[model samples]
Target: MNVKGKTILITGGASGIGLEAAKQFLEIGAKVIITGRNQAKLDVVKKSFPSITAIQSDAGKEEDAQSLFNKVNDLGGIDILYHNAGVGVPPLNLGVPNNNHLKGAIYEMEVNYFGVIRLNNLFMDMLKSRDEAAIIHTTSILSIVPSAIEATYSSSKTALAFYVQSLRKHLQIINSKLKIFELLPPLVDTDMVADRDDKKISPAQLISGLIIGLENDKYTIRIGDSKVIYLLNRLLPKVALNLINPNKYNEKLIN
Candidate 1:
């Protein structure tokens, strides 16, 4: 899709991938409005990118979703619904059960999975009404190749991937102009994974791949090592599992 002159709404736009994408979209001449839960962060982003619109809204809350829809609806609808809001699951500590971790897992589901669904249901009709529109979900390679340390996170993305897959079929059945795109990105150098020294791609690389994918109409855009990870998981599940979660199933732990 042409980024120029499009009305784009991105959730969790305060930082990381969403923030970077919002900046790039603005540079492409799109009317971008970004939503985040932190008003202070939103204000900071707004100041930095005066041309972009920033709003404070929690993607995990139904009322906030409604408010977001109302606001966007007032702006004459959005051309792209970018579901970028999600949280990482806390690192799992083996051989010990932590109640707080369990609670964090549940919260992760609410934000990563349920919130996307709720916002999509609310904004889907608007997108369908547009002549050219797309819904982009920022999932992860973990959806295809699970990591035991990120159990809930993997499950949530897997569920979202399933939903987006099915939604594509339904859209085709109705002959709708709406396009469903899933962005599966590998570990990137973002605030979300700042501490990690894993082989990570830059945000610029991620957005560059995204634009190329969109221009070519790649429905499922796999960025960085995600494509490799996906194929390995499909063709050699055990090897893929061992590579992604070595700590969880180390030789010592398994033996």
Candidate 2:
């Protein structure tokens, strides 16, 4: 779990949180390989951190993930699979109609949900092939509760959280040396949440907490408002579920 000398792969690793995490991993002396949909952005990141291996790949594609596995195999092996790629869709104008919802759902599912599935399935084999490894998913606080505004994004993250937990149980059954962790970050000031008028944690702080959690072998890590999720889940289940319900009754939308 030590960051030093470990090789880590982070999907969607070009900008925002992914980029921030990549930068931190480089500082921690880990060999960092980052993937993203945009080659141009990866180029810019390379200019800043030449040590990182930036691969231009769409994590939404299973074939791309398989190719990623090939890349990892060529590297000898990987110590950590940081599933950091994601997207936020369902543009504000359409207001969650069926078509817009479907579009958003596809984008979100492709990147956030199924993308994780393919990445995990492919990298997990490589991880188990090694002596020890770690698998981490970057989800959102919305995964536990509906945040109202990001309908499609929220739903996909919610599904991702469930998937991570399920993966953990399966790993226990197989008795794999690979450890699984989930990061439920609060609202962040990234392109994904640039329009939202909400408080956000800086990317560096989030990365700092994330590194500490992973290195310490913490099973699941939550930062900022996501900590509220753990507290609410433990102390107030009904209120937690109600908070996740989108508050349609109090709001004028569905009421």
Number of the top lDDT candidate: 1
Measured with C-alpha atoms, the lDDT of residue 238 in candidate 2 is: 77
Q: Please write out the lDDT profile of model 2 over residues 1-255, one tens digit for every residue.
A: 777898999888999999999988888899999999899999999998888898888988878888878877897768899988888863443353556667778988999899898878777777887777899898888777775556678889989999999989998999988899999898788887676555789999999999999889998899987898768978997787676554543343433
Error of 1 at 51 (Å): 1.2
lDDT (Cα, tens digit) per residue for candidate 1, span 19-117: 989988887888999999999999999889898888789988989999989988987889998998899865665446668677877788899889999
Reference-based lDDT, each prediction: 0.87, 0.83
Give the Å shift of residue 55 in candidate 1.
0.8
Clashes of each: 0, 0
RMSD of each: 2.3, 2.9
By summed lDDT, the worst window of 10 consecutive residues in model 2 runs over: 246-255
Clash list (residue pairs), candidate 2: none
